[model samples]
Target chain A: MTRFASAQSIAHDIRSGKRSAASTMQAVLNTITQHDSAIHSVTHLFAQQAMQQAHAVDAMVARKEPLPPLAGVPFGVKDLFDIQGHVTTAGSIVLRNTPPAAQDAALVARLRTAGAIPVATLNMDEFAYGFATDNAHYGITRNPHDTQRMAGGSSGGSAAAVAAGFLPFTLGTDTNGSIRVPASLCGVWGLKPTLGRLPRAGAYPFSASLDVVGHFTGTLEDLRNIFYIMADTPAEPEPQDLRVACLGGWFAQNLSPALAAAISRVCAHLGLTGTTELPQTPTARAASFVITASEGGTLHLPRLRAAAEDYDPATRDRLLAGAMLPASTYVQAQRFRRWFREQVHAAFEQVDVLIAPSVMCEAPLLDNPTIMVGGKPASARANLGLYTQPLSLPGLPVLCLPLSNTGTLPLGLQLVAAPGREAALFSLARKLEQAGLAGRYPHNTQQAA
Target chain B: MTSPPFSDEVLVAARAQAMELALPPACVAGVIANTRVLQNYAALIRDFPLPDTCEPAGDYTP
Candidate 1:
């Protein structure tokens, strides 16, 4: 069987006599062990525990007990998510001596209940701080499509593992585009649910106000199904008629030629002729940055004070700067956020889903970590969230999906909906997937483990 | 935005002193560079006009 199977198909195989859960788990672990050398997506593997869980699934099947929807499906958690008994390093040495978690993170616990096995702890930016998963403690998570290129962070490892077909799905957290940017760069399906819609318990905190718990999947169906399970909500109907519009002005500025052309194709398919623009787009992005830095810096202030040397140099510097930001700056940014949120919320009155590029371009090369912004080179680490940061300001639900066959490494698009309207995002993503306009590019050719 | 309230080195030294957190010699340069980035962002939203009624978005005042 091809290792690039989706979670749905894996579950089907396990439920039927097509494959044993134990064998499926072994194949997944073996694939990572043999193929993850270059990608560095996995930090630790729960080999023994995963195998034991798999055998139990096989037993359940032999007994003819009803199988769970995701029975025997293997997935990975971003290192920051607590996986009971394992010390959640959050990709830093500072928490190395911290106690092991008493219980699974809320979402992890939910997946475990659904019979999904947590197979590994994935790599990420330390404490989920930077956009680049260039962790100081753990090595960088290289893009599966092009190893020399980046897998955007701080959720880089989670995205790369799915892109590599090492796991069918993986969990990630987004605060100012952690989930969207990497999923875009890695060419996978990702969802940033409405702020606080999903449980955040046991997941490591970054920015209290902006932080969100989400996941990345290889296919749109798995993305939708797993979300409902984690949300503990019944599946909502996908609306057939969606009021869709492409975002303009600030969102329209950057173009990588190919990305611009692809966007045009999707807009044309949707019969969209004009674009809707958000008010004061640049300032919105600035507000997102300010809020995230302030909250994240404040959250880690105690630890930073005690053990600043334990942090990744880049993360430490950013947190240090964030901690010292004037209280007025934080308050003013929040005030701006209120105004900006109202403006966007009003825009939703006319449009059901807004379309935008997830990243300005495909993943950047590791050697030259720069992206073209305003026709000038800009640091990828800082500017990768140009599109995503603004959206985060309003706590809206966004779905980032890879555009298929862009003739390069992977480029992605974002489908945004009003708060609590994740169903709308999925409906539009499904239509694009059917149109052959959005989906993951096949990576199984290189290492069809 | 161009006229920052304080010099980077001066502000860092003062903030460090007030918080009683030691700024390691090696970390100062990186911290200053990052602070400069934040200063530019702070400038962008610093003076934007907002209605007096606008409260901090998610900030709850009990």
Candidate 2:
């Protein structure tokens, strides 16, 4: 197995003339061609265009021109993001005949401008609805750690690609744990920045209010650097001596012994003595779900009416039900959302960051397709977002960090902060990484002897 | 959570007519099951007491 390099390391080598950009891009494409079959993470590869872009970066370097921060780094996007002249299928066949996108999505355009080449479009849950990336259109994306288990999707492909070491980073969206769940299961560093912190133009919509575009990377530094580049903002310095707390109540309930122990170790390392509770967490989670269903259903109602047969059976059924939701219910969900946001903001007054488990356990087996929720076997597709959904209600920044040395499949911990305080999350995650408690799960071939 | 406001028969009818959904007969059962789940979630948010002053999150100016 190839040892994957971070975006920072790749750019450093290219900029110093230690390696040519074309060679790096070719290697990435070759790796995807050779290895991606086992994981099924990539949906479409842009080999020719990516190679041309890599040559352009090399030309600039030869001419002694200033290089961008991400010069020649290869990245992938969830199929929902539009790349110029390419059809954005959004992991479904319904849009197969649609005209090619005239331009890149807003964030994609930003990454391109910074010299990161888009090499492929990754698979996702059809229409970004389910937690499992079991698209009827695109075959299910199996976890790279263990092919029989799920990758924990709608952004499963994005996480799996990074976990498989095929790309330095890949873009994904988090509406209701789409990014976090997959990142947790795949053991990659994923960031769902504060909602609205990154632009979303040209990306296919799921829930207008809940959708957040983010990315997954194998390194914490890469996650932070790429986030600032996409946001087009200068990095904010992380404040020292930040107060942190563990979340209890709903977040504390479900746990595999390994996951619970991991969280305890993190808390112990942070010296946290007690846990903070999010008020009305179950209700908050419920509100997030209702709002997502209503918005997503409303957005796709016209398409469902016209081409209902073109959708995945699972997605079609869910969207049909969401469309039938009473108007009063959607209104109430929004109302409750406003109230909940205020309560969450107030809770942030006492702690700068909060730590919680990203998923209850490791990825569930594809054959069983269930997770132990509240001590009962529940559908993984429905309940994988139990911890992530409530946090989504407030649109806070959450960094899903993979726990190291857990002696099992990947388990992730969410380092959450108030809106626009991603620096705090980065700060906390870095501390954990330095302490040998958090990092990417090494693939079998890359693990030390 | 409170009980769903509509009966199963009513919901099935509403899905076809009001929602303009034309799911196959086999698909109807799954749609109905998912609708029940959404309704349960909606019920949890519906009863939160809010003043008349509370406004929906529209275009967030901030």
Candidate 3:
């Protein structure tokens, strides 16, 4: 009965004794066991530990003790997040034999403190390097909306779990659109908080300059609630009269008709007639790629030397290339980032939130694995981040909300705001959600296998 | 900045050896293909000029 339920509603159900946490946890595990074979989102299910925690919550409920806001709510984390007693393989075989994590990842610890149970560890691209969650070691995590399409990564499993309703929310890390791209393709709400806005203490590092720990949720409410709980800050008030603009130039190009029309509807609702553009966006995207490759390559250089064969070939080549990149290229990308951040910050001063497409098209079919770019097919793994990569350069907070009633599979739009302006993005997203512009993908219409 | 004149094959071989990473024979082609792609990106960033005062976005605390 708790399957597909929002975290907020589940917590409410447990606190009111409408359902025991044990039963809820059992139901969650059952649903995942039943449905996840199609999506392949889950990697390791902590069945016994999750049941124990759920029973503990039920016991506390019996005592009429004050419950944390999300007590007994089930959630998952990308395999990279440390879960105390488990090895964080980070979707790679190289670390399969490493020691178990000494403690839970910081955000996971916060959620546990608030009574949320860690239900499972989800799949991802090997070493968090690729856009396609087509992991050779873990098996591909298929898009829940359509089993044959990709669930974008390196946070693909986290997003797919939420999209498939296996978990109310799941933790993910985004360096170059990992969260947003998958969240978009999977038809869920994803937040990439301002750089450093949330702790990344235990999430496996990838592109340290760009990595930001965030989460994917089926509902906007859970996205907001869990984010504040993880950030350990009281929620900021949402501004009513917000300045919003849609991004043009690089963002406005190469869109599917449905996504472009959806953007039109939202802009028309806001009475917006003018658009804004970020300068040198293509270069910004390029810079994002170079920096991620270089940093990620450097991080694993030592291991790659000893155990390169253990890595997924799709990821191994990219990491090796990234590792081999010249230092000047890496530095120039960083320098461009500095100038670009100033420009982005200046634009933000005039607007509260900027709207853009999260991914240009709907989920790309796993068989084809390409999207139209300049009227030609391009690799989905490399180009899925076209819009998202440019935004990552400045480390702005971006909220990817699935557009409602779009074409067959789901389409998503990005609500980007100034650094630390997640509240503004949330407020704007809520407006679109209330206006019938955005919501989770309809399960009734899931793509056929 | 001028890029090295060697071919991508040479680049991979030289870099792997320099880093003391013994690239497996099977992995060479894939690595070279990836390197070529990144070089395009590298050229883009290298060509774009910034003010002399522009520094690497090292702090990453935006």
What TM-score fits each model?
A: 0.98, 0.97, 0.98
Mind giving the per-residue lDDT tens digits that candidate 2 earns over A71-168? Answer: 99999999999999999999999999999999999999999999999999999999899889999998999999999999999999999999999999
Q: Which segments of model 2 are wrong by more than 4 Å?
A: A1-3, A447-449, B1-6, B60-62
What DockQ results for candidate 3?
A: 0.80
- Lowest lDDT 10-mer window, candidate 2 chain A? A440-449
Q: Model 1 - which docking category? A: medium
Q: What does DockQ give for each predicted structure? A: 0.61, 0.70, 0.80
**Cα deviation of A354, candidate 1, in Å:** 0.1
Please give the RMSD of candidate 2 to the true structure.
1.6
Worst 10 residues of 1 chain A by lDDT: A440-449
lDDT of 3 by residue, A1-449 (tens): 87679999999999999999999999999999998999999999999999999999999999999999999999999999999999999998889889999999999999999999999999999878888888889999999878889999989999999888889999999999999999999999999999998999999998999999999998999999889999999999999899999899999999999899999999999999979999999899999999999999999888888888899987888898999988999999999999999999999889999999999999999999999999999998889999999999999999999999886698889999999889998899999999999998888633222
Candidate 1 Cα deviation (angstroms), residue A260 = 0.1
Q: Give one digit per residue, the lDDT tens place, for model 1 in A324-346.
A: 88899999999999998889889
- The residue-level lDDT of candidate 2 at B6 comes to 71
What's the lDDT for residue A291 in model 3?
A: 96
